[model samples]
Target: MTPRKGERPPVPEPLPAPVVDAHTHLDACGAKDAADVSTMLDRAESAGVDRVITVADDLASARWAAEASTWDSRVFAAVAIHPTRTAEFTDADKAEIERLAQQPRVVAVGETGLDYYWDYSPPAAQHEAFRWHIDLAKRVGKPLMIHDRDAHADILKVLTEEGAPETVVFHCFSGDLEFAKACVERGFVLSFAGPVTFRNAAPLREAAAFTPADQLLVETDAPFLTPHPFRGRPNEPYCAAYTLRDLAALRGDDVAELASAVSGTADRVFRLRTVTSDLPNGEGLR
Candidate 1:
């Protein structure tokens, strides 16, 4: 039977089932309202993205991300001051972040690290703020999510000197093969993002191939860095399939197996065990 003229069209068939988006920013994305949030989650859920770790780079966004986590079992929160915004970091801000980190839904302590590309904040300040975040992660016994952009040496030095939490994740890892080897040797997880799917990102693809099985993860870094075939458009958590496919190709591994492995890595690093039942689909929650 034909549908009514005012009736809504059926949703598209969902992507492959049981995919996990290791990193994203649900609150900062298009989900500014309850309806928008629900729609976004529905899109992701329909795409087989069972879970996402929504990250916030500032206090206000952190609160929003935390609240979003409460609104949906599929969402989790990662809070910290982005390196570019280090000027806004203060003791009180740290306190608030620490408090949020103690919350049941908060997973990791970053999206924080050095960003020499913009240099929005002084390098020294970025380093100082990064150290403080590392300390906070240690104090709370949570993993650290690092963001390194054109500051690989400095990042390595800081992590080696100040010492990172037991679990350190280098999100959107774009480093060279040597850096990838070093990170693997140090037992740090390297999370590949949309850039890895670019044709010109051969170096990143090489790094992706070098990441050890247990130390590899995948993310969308959404609303930005949309993977190939979808570049130049706003990214979303549901687009993580591109990254997973690229990583699997680079490593010559089965896509399904790699996807499941990275999901497990994310689960362990983010302490998803404590919040599995609260997660959607009963997959990769712990």
Candidate 2:
């Protein structure tokens, strides 16, 4: 069923413990300035999502994401040229992305990888750009977050060919049991989003259940993929709390236990730290 446009999902009850949103898009969610960022994170914090990593899809958003990370201590950023937007990638663009990748507040290089579901960019162009982003992640010593949408095999293939970064994350992971095994075997982090709660996602549930707690993460991918019962509605970082509850129920694990595992994994993988204290008089990132 399609939710009416502009229909926002209700904020869910707080989790038993705090959890980080491994991925979200604050710019797309209508956050224009520090106040907007603060208000958005305040809702998320109230729902037990105390932190988040806002990911960028292109250069403009990448710049915005890096600056947004400074707007609030609860936020971190990941910058990359998404595969679908790589058709016209240029040297200057590459340089800028590399620069952003090195920023202290930018925790990862991603929302990168193949997206065969869309024809917005040709496969060859996407392949070339994906390789470049893979190398950038390695060079910067940061985790690589992937966006595999119907290109799982090629995504794996390229990572193998390019030599993945020390830490890798399959954001909004969309694979089955066997693919999940492949990622787990290689020690790749699989970040589950709202789709695992969908009624038609049994295979996804199987994959989620099979993922070791240490290799697992949860996200909202906000402004999209709102969890079931609230599917088709607008999503935000707070909705990550709802996804966590459903994931725990689906995996038959204790919510607090899973939340702890997820939180620990996020801290370790992203090398996250308390940055709000770094802001001058708590004035936010400059």
Candidate 3:
């Protein structure tokens, strides 16, 4: 069956091996409820994108993502207030997030970080909220997934000053080779999205190239950033396969090899134990 009118991009071919979508927003991607989530996961699984970390950019979505993870064994959640909404981040928001952060299904503490591109909130507020998130991540002992958009320098400074959590991921990394190298030097993971596959994204492609195998990840960030041929259309978790395949092609590595590598990295970073559950629910294949 073809995707409906709102869902413009139909499912593409399955990947050579299974992988994980390290960052995405189920609500933003048009999944209204648990049933919609299952449908989205079905499409993703069909394309060999076996598991996903559905992220939240606000308190309501964070609540939704936390609950959504419980709907399926394959879905996990990351909860946080977005940089663009820092001004709105309040005591109530922090309290709710604190409660949500403790949920077993919630994996990382993020989609948090600075976004200088959009000034929806004052810079001072954004910094304050970022500090709060960093502390929350450390308290919860979960990875911190960052959303750096045109604020790499301040991002580095803030993380350095606050002392980053044990694990940090640069979600939808949109940096040049130098920025990429700087991130890599600090032991941060760079998660590539649809932009890496664009015809003109030579710099993003270059960063994807020299990135360490174990420190790389893939995502759709969809209902947005759809890959290459599917750019300008609605993206879904299934579309991550396109980005992964494109990365494999760019690096001249075997598709299956790259898939396995990223999958393992995602498993550790998100600590989504079900990631390797492809074997069986019980003690089947280790």
Residue range with the least summed lDDT across 10 consecutive positions in model 2: 273-282
> What stretches of model 2 exceed 4 Å from their correct place?
1-5, 274-286
CA lDDT, candidate 3, residue 89: 78
lDDT of 2 by residue, 1-286 (tens): 9657678887778889999999999999999999999999999998999999999999999999998898888999999999899889999999999998888889999988999999999999999999999999999899999999999999999999989899999999999999999999999999999999998999999999999999999999998999988888889999999889999998899999899899999999998963343346757642
Number of the top-ranking candidate, with lDDT as the measure: 2
Tell me the number of clashing residue pairs for each predicted model.
0, 1, 0
How displaced is residue 52 in candidate 2, in Å?
Answer: 0.6
Instruction: Estimate, for each residue in 1-286, the C-alpha lDDT of model 1 and write its tens digit.
Output: 9655333233334544356687898765668855676687777777666788899988899888776776667788889989999876788888888888877788889889999999589999999999999998999888899999999999999998998789899998989899899889999999888999899988888888878878888888887888876676777887887677767777898877887788788778887867643345643332
lDDT of 3 at 63: 92
Top TM-score hit? 2
TM-score of each: 0.90, 0.96, 0.93
- All models: lDDT? 0.81, 0.92, 0.89
lDDT of 3 at 192: 96
TM-score, candidate 2, is 0.96
Instruction: Show where candidate 1 strays beyond 4 Å.
Output: 1-17, 276-286
Model 3 TM-score on a 0 to 1 scale: 0.93
Ranking by TM-score: 2, 3, 1
